[model samples]
Target: MATFHHYPFCPQSRFIRLVLGEMGIAPATVEEKPWERSQSLLMINPAGHLPIFVEEQGLAVPGAAVIAEYLDETRGLGLDGRRLLPDHPADRVEVRRLMEWFLVKFFEEVSAYLVTEKIYKRFMKAELGGGPPDMAAIRAGRSNVRYHLQYIGFLIGKRNWLAGPDLTYADLAAAAHLSCVDYLGDVPWEEDETAKAWYARVKSRPSFRALLTDRVPGMAPAAHYEDLDF
Candidate 1:
């Protein structure tokens, strides 16, 4: 069986996992702490990243975006469900556009800061200069998240899914990041009915059930993190 190395709170890892789930491919999972800089991780991914996908024959695919596309090409096409990527060239562009928006823009502006401060710092060794969560960064992430939430509402309002008619990797990417932030109790869902409704729909998917069960060591998920009705 293929093997997947990842950490629970990492959005990139979560994105890859969701994509794998959509592909109906279950790789043997191995939890990894990249902050620890394990020799095994460095060997698998010279970039020293989390969410490395190693095939049965020992082909290691690193990074979430790369792994997502790799799976779509190798497994997604033959899967017994909706295709993760659109067939048309224009639609593919839109899917990649939104995927980049959530993975890069939203991540840089919000999720990255929050995860680095809130989750990574807590488990990170003191020798690595890890410390208490930075209140300033956390506040900034919280403020930035609202704008992204509005953007999500804007996108979903015009389409059935974030990208287009069918659910694409774009939806998975957005949900992956938002779900991590939501796990931290940082999402203000009550403020945006449209985005919240869209998220509720995503949350109800069978593929998302495993993510809802994720539990960080010392931190419990937000009250509504796993609640389908929320």
Candidate 2:
């Protein structure tokens, strides 16, 4: 039994939750306000990041990479119906590459705006800037998302999964980060049919169900959120 310490709206935290649900682990939830630098959260992970997992091993795991790898190697294969990280070495590298693209690159360009404006503000009021969310930044992010989605569409057209032949960590990372954007109806799904189709496949999985249910304060998910076709 693991205890997943999370911030509800953090995409990475939700990514771990989706993995737990897929693994059928039903981890104990410990929602922490990560930006507040709480002694408890920091005690678990001195880095003070959300989704710090208190593992079955009696140690705390920090970051999505660490948690995902731990579960995929030790637990996901046995417990999850869908293997997140494939075994083929070459395929695995592609997965890592795509995961880095979305989790690091996509996040720097997009998630930073929405997550900070919408979710973090509610939890860590102490850390907020005096100015409001920059609509210009938000606009640029939305535009950038179109390009990423197009790239994903290309990948989907060429490969069965985001990373070569298997649905690996890359797929989950993309969906996880995108879910936050989707929650705010920020995704322009109709513009790219191929991207929408690929997203539909990822979001349709049983592991993704819990993430679809998460509701942020004052922000409701779009009507199509629960719709598998969308």
Say which candidate scores most in lDDT: 1
Q: Number of the top candidate by TM-score?
A: 1
User: Model 1, 1-230: lDDT tens per residue?
Assistant: 99999998899899888888777788999999868889989999989987899999999999988887888788865255777887789999999999999889999999998989999999888889588988999999999999999999998889999999888999999999999999999999888899999899878987888999999887888888889998
Clashing residue pairs, candidate 1? none
* Residue-level lDDT tens digits of model 2 in 60-103: 88988788888877786625365777777876778888988987
Superposed on all Cα atoms, model 1 deviates from the true structure by an RMSD in Å of: 1.2
Worst 10 residues of 2 by lDDT: 122-131
Per-residue lDDT value at 56 in model 1: 97
The lDDT values for all models are 0.89, 0.80
Cα misplacement distance, residue 180 of candidate 2 (Å): 0.6
Counting clashing residue pairs in each candidate, in order, gives: 0, 0
